[model samples]
Target: MRRIITTIDIGTTAISTIVAERQKDGGIRILGVAQGPTFGMRRGSVVDIDEVTVSLKKTIQEASKASGMNIKKAVVGVGGTHINTYNTKGVVAISRADGEIAEEDVRRVIQAAENSIPKNPNREIIHIIPREYKIDNESGIKDPVGMTGIRLEVDAMIVDGSKSALRSIIKCVEGAGVEIDDFIFSSLASAEAVLSRRQKELGVMLLDIGGGTSNYSVWEEGRLVQAGVFPVGGTHITHDIAVGLQVHIDTAEKIKLEYGHAIPELFSKKDVIKLADFGLNGDDVYLKRHIAEIVEARFKDIFELASKELKRIDRFGLLPAGVVLIGGASHIPGIEEIAKKELRLPIEVGKKVNLPQPTDKNLQELLFTYPVALGLVAWQVNQLSGDNRYFYNPTFESVSSKIKNWFKVFIP
Candidate 1:
């Protein structure tokens, strides 16, 4: 059985796409991967449908050329400030003559959790994942089916997003001539590619720092505990540089990528370079230390908020596996030190993908940054195999292929 899936991860700065062929052993072999410019988006939400649609089309076409595979449908990853998460519990009476909780009981309790969601037509629930189960006096149960209990309960993590924002993204994908097979929260998708089961079980935090927003999620005892999106991201650093140096946005971006450092102390007073040295201008000269200072302050703005959020949950410095940083912005040279100093935890940039991956040199080196896109393809494989320990996948039923008889379901 062969299962090939394509995925698109839309960020404020860029759009990432992946075409992968799932092997018989349930591993992903990347056929194609590409990164393209993103426009008409801010903080992960679509601001201009027309601009995003055009960008999506070009990115998909590029991926097709790279993989030599026709791209038609894709699993999309969604994240932004408009997305919200809640930790909630649901209760129900078990329906069994022997007082044992049945499969239906579990389903009913989960539905009850969904019912706890506040009624907002403007918002749609995208993920309703079970955190733990409780049977009467017993709590912290991972699985409750067939357990003897009169009362059944479930603690679930619910993620919902602005309906209008989601619609705008869907319209852009469809406008690009690609059907949406399924949609997932961006952080959840990243977790699939970089986070391991051991990390989840021991407690870990993943921060996916993008251009416009920093998306973070927490897992404890192998369940989603908390998650959120911060409006601040790497773009803030670019803006700081542009304002400080009186440079254009494009120049600021280039400087940030090529010479930006998170720690100012790493540079010396004599370590200065002129614009002409970077092929920009012949006269203007600046200190690299100054550039690093601008970058550090903007990052402080991001990490301060993150620290506050961790304090709210009482998980600061608590995760044994510490913090795993992914996404495009996390690729900066000395970011882990900043993360460690502010977060006060053991921090390491996420690398070393577990998937049976592509051999392209650039794509192989960039695999860490493409977790969300890679995870979307992995999501499809997990769906077929009933692997719910990582993410509870809601069916992506709309515009799904009308015929499903061609591929045999491969279960590992």
Candidate 2:
């Protein structure tokens, strides 16, 4: 039987599973998908182990049933404030073997770089992405293999996360009876879904506004430049609306989705919405301006947070392709306009590609919310088939081994 790859995205508000089969043409055929309301997670961190396990099993079982395949292993996405990155450097004496560099040389240099990472008890390195490689006196070489050099140097960005957080996610998957092939950063996964080759080459920022958190990844010259996660997200907006309008959380959420606009003027004053629950006098009371104000205030705050993050990275005006917004909160009306105004760059809503055409256009419109889930599936397929197109290097075995060692040091 042909093997299939599954990906489970246990996000802040939802757990989604996707199954895909490798195709002959090096592409993926999505076999099935399932999503359910997430439990035991808040702001992208696993909190309740049992709740997360139940949700994971339910979503996985649904997807497995649809695909008619038993998924035993998967690539999962991890994101939270605990995720962090730092720069590290490594140098190695190039062996004089016909004056040519080999893959092993590059791998050794990476391992040397990995040595620079501090063995923190609470954190483990998740990924080591080379920013640039230098061979002898030559600088800015992306690939060192097959090059002629006496000394090799490398600068890499090391991504690390809290050991407890990672262990929680791993335990949840194991409890669900699924093996974790790999754990990908949530922002990185979202970047894979919406960022184009040109965008990465030219420099771009991917901002995924999820239910309980907003994650960001910066790409420049076709490499991951930086990544981060903020605790604020769509849930904050709902909370603001609920408090401002004196309505229940569910009602506030519905109001935000149905009539929310980042810009108040985007919704006309004459266009009124009835709020039966929030009304002070009557059930049919209408308040168009009030709702717009509440949404606009929350959106402005979210955009301002994004702006601060961009400015802190000094990439506010540097990204050639600007910002690509994905995830559930990106569905808010006028969000693109808000991003453009706040970030002072081009903004567009990101959508998931490589999916079958849906009969319902409305459902198609909602696909952008599933970018992380879809990207997880894409990452899983790449891992299963040894596709290194997404990463700078392609070998999973070497990478996994390095991470395993790092995990041991971190957890111990």
Q: Which candidate is the best by lDDT?
A: 1
Relative to the true structure, candidate 1 reaches a TM of 0.91
Please give the clash total of every predicted structure, in order: 0, 0
Q: Which stretches in model 1 have alpha-carbon errors above 4 Å?
A: 355-366, 393-412
User: Against the true structure, what is each candidate's TM-score?
Assistant: 0.91, 0.89
lDDT of 1 at 184: 86
Q: Count backbone overlaps in model 2.
A: 0
* Candidate 1: Cα lDDT at 349: 83
Cα lDDT of model 2 by residue, 190-294, tens digit: 766567778888988888888888898888887777888888888888898888877779888888888777777755667786765444345654466677778
lDDT tens readout by residue for model 1, 117-184 = 66775666778788889999999999898789899988888888887788788779989999887678
